[model samples]
Target: MSTNKEMKTATASTLNQHVHPFDQLTGDEIIQTAAIVRQAKPEVDLVFNTITLKEPNKQVMLSYLGWDTSKPRITKVEREALVVILEKVTMKCYEAIVSLTHNTLKSWTYMPDVQPMLTMDDMFEVEELVLKDEKVIQECRELGITDMSCVFNDPWAIARHVSHPGREKRLMQALMYMRTCEEDNQYAHPLDFVPIIDLGLKKVIAIERIKPRDSKYSRPTIPLQQHNFLPEFVGEENYRKDVKPIIIQQPQGVSFTVKGNEIDWQKWNLRISMNYREGLVLHNISYQDGPEKRPLFYRISLSEMVVPYADTNTPHHRKHAFDVGEYGLGLCTNSLQLGCDCLGSIYYFDAVFNDHNGQPVEIPSAVCMHEEDYGILMKHTDYRNGRAHTIRSRRLVISQIVTVANYDYGLYYYFYQDGTFEYEVKATGELNTHVLAEDESAAGMGTIVAPQINAQYHQHFFTMRIDPMIDGQNNSVQQVDTYTLPYPTGHPKNPFGNGFTSDYTILKDTKEGQQNACYETQRFWKIVNTDRIHPYSKTPVGWKISSGHTAPFFAKDDSLVAERAGFAKKTLWVTPYDENQMFAGGFYCNQSGGDDTVEVWANREVQDIQQKDIVLWYTFGITHLPRVEDFPIMPVEYCGFTIKPCNFFIANPALDVPPTNKKINHSVLAHENSSKGEGPKSCCSTKL
Candidate 1:
């Protein structure tokens, strides 16, 4: 290959007075002319310019030209006039050579960084010399034969070809060309050269294109679009207003007594009242009625007056009549006992009655009775002076009542060893059944219970009672009982309030051993935000679209079994054209106060448009699953997510921000012509 020093020396040697263009002058005459031009154009700086000339039979002629090179000015008027003459001569040279050789003369203009080579051997390998020269000559010949006289006139094209496979070379050539062109008096249309130079830039550096010898893998595919969509509940405002209110009422006829720190009940009874306009009946109530058979025929209903209680303030305590009416006679042996040797028994039964039309009605019921030995209740007894010992005594009290829709529906009563009676009842079927906690288990028992109960009578009713104790011991137990009725419509065993569907989709499988309690892995329903005071139309909607290329990925084990990873990142994508939006991991709500900006190409000009048809693309999610070897120092994976417009914005609100065009007068660019004295004769006046 030719070196810079050798090429520069050869070029200078070629500047002889014997050359055709300068043959009109002798050596002494050339020196005198040069001195005269130098003296007249003292401000001008001189620089050497190279040009390549081709002859017949693969011959090349390298020539040099001298011109002014002052700050911001390259040539004197004399040099400018000479350049015009030289351009015409060069055109003529092409025309004249057309007849001598079948090949046309293609002008290969390049930047200052392009060294002039006299032969193919100077720039290419010996084996490639003939092929490269032949290809160039063949192309020139074809152009000449076709009358295409302006073939290969672009300086950028020549520079790109010379810098092929070398990005650094291309950059150097581009920079030098821009600098030289600006300094030359031949600055006719310099701005038009930008695109030509950009076209020659290599897409990838040579170092990046190298492949590992043992690798045999293809690149991964990347999706062009991804976005996230968060759905909200619709009609939320109306649902909150329609739910019924529930009030907690206190228990009645309930009393407690303590004597010498021990309980001693002398009597026990229970009472219940039903206020349904029509008589009621309950079914499917069972218990150890007599320890012989599970008979289900015990039933009753309130017909008239409220059951009265004993008049005495102290009353018989446990011996009161209201106790009988409060605590129904149904009980079963499975019921728990409080004190040692208490031996409590529980029984279950159902109330049956008839409506105004005599139709059958039934409701499930349960009751428990205790029969403790007197020895347990006499725990604190003491003898003083042998005069009929007496120490302590206590009493047990219990009461319960349940009402539903203004109808008395449940009742409970308890008797204490200390002769106290307690009666209580409460309203039923008024409870909020949702609002689960995050760590709730799938078993449906937690700090709160919201069983989904429907109004349809035939639909099975389910209620989960968390005892937290069972089998006479504190063995935690969660019992879920389901009951089915025959009617099509009836009162709900449990009410539904704050109507809202719990719904969501799980993008990944639950981690092993995750309870997934109140933490539902899937979406049950869509939620929409309707609380905005204004209607949907009044709210401005906008979407921003963006796109980006992701970083390359590689396998964990460095195994060739898997394909070479390309841009595998999952990107967030939003489409204003379509309602669907997606994010790499999953769609989240489009609420504000987040990383709001979308990813876009670094060059903003690429997305300029007049309408709102922008689609934003974001990459996120796991690009590759980790392998065992990827443990300790796990390689970082590339992932990205984005949020973009979802038909949520009105048309260009920023249109009136500013207009971008401005005009300036070029008269300020004019300068006085100082090279008039040093004329075109300088071109012929050569010092050789």
Candidate 2:
């Protein structure tokens, strides 16, 4: 084991590469893992898949979290083990899970290691698989194309895409493109031949080509040589000089202090870590409640993001992607630059990702922590008495962004001074673009952007994993809604329709807890710690979950997406804690059709969710309609949900704030006795 000094030095040395200590798999470790795996299984027909650091089981991690300082035991950080997957060169592709501790192979699990057939095919590179097929070249020959270029397509929404009905399988489709090596616009050039290949057989089962209706061209073809679509700014055009926001800092500097990954504000105390799957994780998050550091959430993270398109056409049907699962969210994180991506005394966090070859690479400033003025958060005014009260709000924003192919998704978790936890999601960047004819109309698939370009329509759905501990751990879900009260015995005022009452329901079982939103009822869900009740309200301390911009999965119940991603069907899901069940779409969802996700786990009819360590999954999405402006680039659209305090605090927590007194100044007016008198001579003259 490495010593503390050695670990610190090692971490500092990797800072030049912008690598995080725990987030990345070191290059040295990867090289050593490769050597060990080869040595362990020397003479086997093994197709190496991935070798990565296997996160330790929760039991072991819990040991660290619950470590007793009074026990007087030596505390040393241990390195995580490695898990390598190797598949046999067979039809079913029997895979083996090889577990290695330090440098020694500890165990292997292979019940023939039969691949789970229900969901996506185990993780594999779509582009690599497409390029490896010799039939792709044959399809190119059939199209009379000599140039070698390929555009990959994902077969996520279409099950019969590779075969007939009732014969669904994991498949990937490839769109053969005509492009010369010297061509400047490779993406613009298109040869309309799509080959649907079975992932298991590695063979082209069918080829769907879009031929010209009037036989105008012998072979299906698109605009050959188009102008470059890549954006370029020459000279000083790329630089920002005259227009920039000036951020003023206080003479005393930032009020908050960050020691390593731990952030300390007025009340919030939490530790953070970044990973390839989940970009940012806040652990041991709690507020200073009186004497002890009261635990609110043990851990909170952005779990899975599924962006399923609405187009039912051939090419667009295979366009869906599991943004977080298929391509790791942290893996696609953008390296943010100062002054551009962030401002005002920002603290940037680094994320380390293991490339396809298992080599560690660092993305600098993958996550940023900064504070922004959120205007007035809390206020109380007495109109009759000329007395006023307010507390100006400053919100600490922790944000991370990931660009998967064309769309850019931003994940933000906000912490306010008044015990409010908010989250925001921003969608920007370009759409999954395509080419169209002059009068094609594009049907219901997409919209026309350029002369012959049909920028397809799509939807982006996101699910946030939240495990709340409101005051204490033993919690239950309380379903609350507003309902119309019975009209008073045919009273004349009954026609006003102004009577209503609040309804409270203790969600008994899983079925009752998994209810959809009702617009008429105006509903919200709350996770309440039944053991911890508020003194004033005489009710359990809880936080309300209110979501917006939510779009449900539009695919048919018998559709591929329905079978594969059942979690998308409902907006909210409540599951009892299962450490293995993390993602809503499931792990290894590359060519997955739907067996490993939360849908599968929820199907077991597991009961006793209430009073247990419960997990809440809020699925929110946008129904995107492509416009001409959405073609080259899209405007930033903001949509998100909030987790606000409900019966959790006795009084306004911001009531203790020192008055900035920006709204009105009664002191100077009273002192001067003049109607036109200004505010106080000193800002802090009045005792808040």
> Candidates' lDDT values, in order?
0.20, 0.63
Model 2 local distance difference test score? 0.63
Query: What's the distance in Å from true for residue 380, model 2?
Result: 4.2
Instruction: Specify the highest-TM-score model's number.
Output: 2
Predicted candidate 2: what Cα RMSD to the true structure?
Answer: 6.9
Badly placed stretches (over 4 Å) of model 1 are 1-349, 354-358, 364-411, 424-688
lDDT for position 549 in model 1: 20
Task: Give a tens-digit lDDT track for model 1, residues 1-688.
Answer: 1111100111111344232221112223223333433343354342111111111110010111111122243221111001000111111111111111122212222222222111111111222222223333353343232222212111111112222423223221110001122222111111111111221222112211111112242211111121111122123453557566322111221132212111223332222222122112121111121232221111122211111111111111111111111111121001222221122221222222222121223333312222322222222222453222221233332222333211232333333333222222321222111111223221222112111110100000100101100001111101111233323343363243323332222111111101111212221111111122123556222212121222222223222101111112112222221122112111110111111122112121232211222222222122222232222122332222111222222332222222111111011122444433332322112234
Tell me the TM-score of each prediction against the true structure. Answer: 0.14, 0.80
Worst 10 residues of 2 by lDDT: 1-10
The candidate scoring highest on lDDT is: 2
lDDT of 2 by residue, 1-688 (tens): 2111101212222545532223345556665665665687676555434445555444344445553234444333345444434344343332333343346666555523222222122334454566556766676667565445434343332333445443234455554444444434444455566676665566666777664333445454365545443444123555556676444343335556765667898788877776667677777678776676666776678777777666676556666777776666776688876666666666776765444344556676778877777787766677797556656688888888887655788888898888888888889876665545434556776776666566666777778888766666567888889978778745665666777888888887667657777787888888898888889889888889888777767778877767766777777888887777878876655556577777667667857777878888877778787887764567888888888788887676666666565333223343355546555443334453
Once model 1 is optimally superposed onto the true structure by TM-score, how far is the C-alpha of residue 489 displaced, in angstroms? 71
